[model samples]
Target: MKRTVLAIDIGSTKICALIAEIDDDNNAQIIGAGIAKAQGLRKGSITNIELASKSIKSALNDAKRVAGTELRSAIVTISGAYTKSLNSSGIVNIPNKEITLNEIQRVMHTSLYNANIPNEFEVLHALPYNFKVDDQDFIEDPLGMNAARLEVETHIITTQKSNLNNLRKAVKAAGVEVESVVLSGYASAIAVLNADEKELGAAVVDMGGNTSNIVIHSGHAIRYNDFLGVGSNHITNDLSMALHTPLHTADNVKITYGSLYAPSNDLIELPVIGDETSSHEVSLEVVHNVIYARVEETLMIIAQSIEKSGLKEHMGAGVVLTGGFTKIEGLRELAVAILDNMPVRLAKPTDVGGLFDTLRDPSYSGAVGLIKYLADGYTAYEIDVNRRMRHAGEESATHTGSLPEEAPKFEPIAPASSTPTSAAPTPPVKDEKIAESATMVNIGSNKPVQDDQPNPISKFWNWATQLF
Candidate 1:
């Protein structure tokens, strides 16, 4: 079957849709995209469902037109000032000497058993960061390993229940069912950060238009998360008021000539867009000051939050920054000035196949990473079906006794057939057994291919994607 995944990124300013085809080998290639001005949402949460629904449907229709295929379900991204996160731990005794997949599931469930989510909040994700087997610490995957007792620590994310429902309803109203909701910060990290940055302990700051999301990671998992209400839009407002110009005019000034860490001593002339005939002689210096002030304030608040995380001391890998606001020239320079302990670098989504060149903006990081997230979670067990079908499978898994097994080696997913193969002749029974035990080989070089992600990240993302 040809599997397609529609990933949507919903922000206060815009909505982005990316569609990719998942091939037999489980590799995903981008095939289509849609971007539309966002509506009915303020600072990431929906206020007007009807308008939001219209915006979503418009974006998806554009994406479907480009893809030449209609998809009814999408895995969407959601964020807001309303989001919250915390850490929790759980312990359990193993009945068997060796751990089994089912036992792993049971312990993970026990970890969240007493997690005290607030009444108005609902769990978005419970990501396991650490695992212990008896006296041994930091056991990444204990399955098939001998252990008497198991312990786990998880990072739990939650958002307002009402907000989640309204967003879900808005997407459903658009005629596209919501497949799953991922926290915007984690999705951005998946798209931008490299394995070394993640494993060596680095903080990723996604500075979007209406909100800036800060995540601290150490020991190969996200340890802390913080959301800042002020963002680039705040800077635009400051510019607007300082220059006596309209908001749209200020936004244009920021995009055209904004600088965060530059000297404002230089002079220039800028005619307000509406009053082009009456040009105002202004120093780039004045524009620089207005932008620098707000951006610096935002950066300082983020640095303080990092200090509070206490992961600041361990951030030897420094900071990796992304999101549209990061595009502002000299933002990294300002960040470097504020965060003296480590260097700050700009990043965007990398290593994605197919539509890599088109989805190059840091703004698209969340959407692209969501594809990687969903693709990495792909297994033989999941069906390429609609939202209702997927929900049923998940419900059945919860009610069933056993958890799904790890991916087994199979014959190189045969080339996507040009003709219907559903009723094609079956392969020889012996060939099937050989394929199961064989290492996947590259066609040209005949070398076995393996996943590039450090095994630990792959395992955790696998479990977390399914669990959420």
Candidate 2:
């Protein structure tokens, strides 16, 4: 199918939009893109609906202009405050000692049922960490195996219903349906972390303008997730306060001279805008100290979160840093210093087929990941049909009758409306079609707190032990 998808990344610093086409071969190629400065949003929370809407509209219009096509829906990236995560498990007895896709689906669903939350919150994602069939672990697929019982572990993420609704309303007002809302940290991981890193366990920290999202993946799946309330914005604020300068000047100074490590006796001079005949002088060390302090503290909290998840010591793949904040000069070095034992690198989006150059920037990681996910083509619900087929085929081995005609059909359904009405209307969607694509994420922990980073192998081992 020749499909086109619009992906939007709404961040505290900026709003980015991308339009991509999925070829019959399932390759997603970026065709258009747009970015606009954000307003009235703080640390991923909407503070002013009108201003946020304007920011979104600007980005959407820019994308429309670039694509030269009208868009009706978009896949969005969500993060920051109000987002939460959890770990849940599901168990199902293998029916008749034959593993079937239906059975697998049932077991997975059983796990999701345990993610209880208030009615005001909605699940954004329920990712399968891995599966264990009768003591055999890490079985990616178990359609035809003979197992007495199946156990599955998954990670669930959810956000406040009102927050999501506000986002949806803004998109709708801009004439687009939110096809899906993915967490920014998760989206960044999709773009940056490789298969091995995911398998061995890794952490991704996306530092945006007003927030930093921390996601921990172990066993090639997301096990722990959280976000820091501070981001680059805090650094800028610190600069403004310390230098007695306006925010605009502080931002410019940060971009121009920010560093995590600076040398003493280092002085640089520059002309202050609108100033008379005097040039302002400042030491690079001063700038570096300010930048280093905030960066290190934030990273420390992220490290602490990983430790609490107990996966910090086991991250064999190390740390992957993405988002706008990563653009700061020497930030990668800063990450390495604070993280302690794990390898640290800046992550940028790679592998898109067309107009790829534009999407390669770290800033666009969320948009790229959202597109990659849409192009992957596998929905969580496909397990049922696969299981049913496997079960029927096994049943046919004993008795011939063309397998019962009871296999079900799968279809796509619109996401249940989160729109608030005059009356309460959000209900648990019972439609099977929606169920097939329905993914549940857990919102269990608040932001985590770790001390210093640890060895990568230790991080991996920690996750490895947790999987069982």
List candidate 2 stretches off by more than 4 Å: 264-280, 356-358, 377-468
Model 1: lDDT equals 0.72
The CA lDDT of each predicted structure is 0.72, 0.70
lDDT of 2 by residue, 145-175 (tens): 8876778887777788898888887777767
Please give, for residues 1-468, the per-residue lDDT of candidate 1 as tens digits: 558999999887889888999765557788888888889988878999999988888889888888999888889888846888777876655544566554455455555555777899877776677889998887866767887667778777788889889989999999988878887887888788776877788898888888888877776677888888877889888887777666887888899887666565666655564565775667777888888888888889988989989888778789988988988988887789898847888998876678756589888888888888776631112112120111112334333322222212112333233234442333212122222222122122223345553344456766787899
Candidate 1: give the clashing pairs: 264-285
Q: Count the backbone clashes (under 3 Å) in each candidate.
A: 1, 29
Worst 10 residues of 2 by lDDT: 383-392
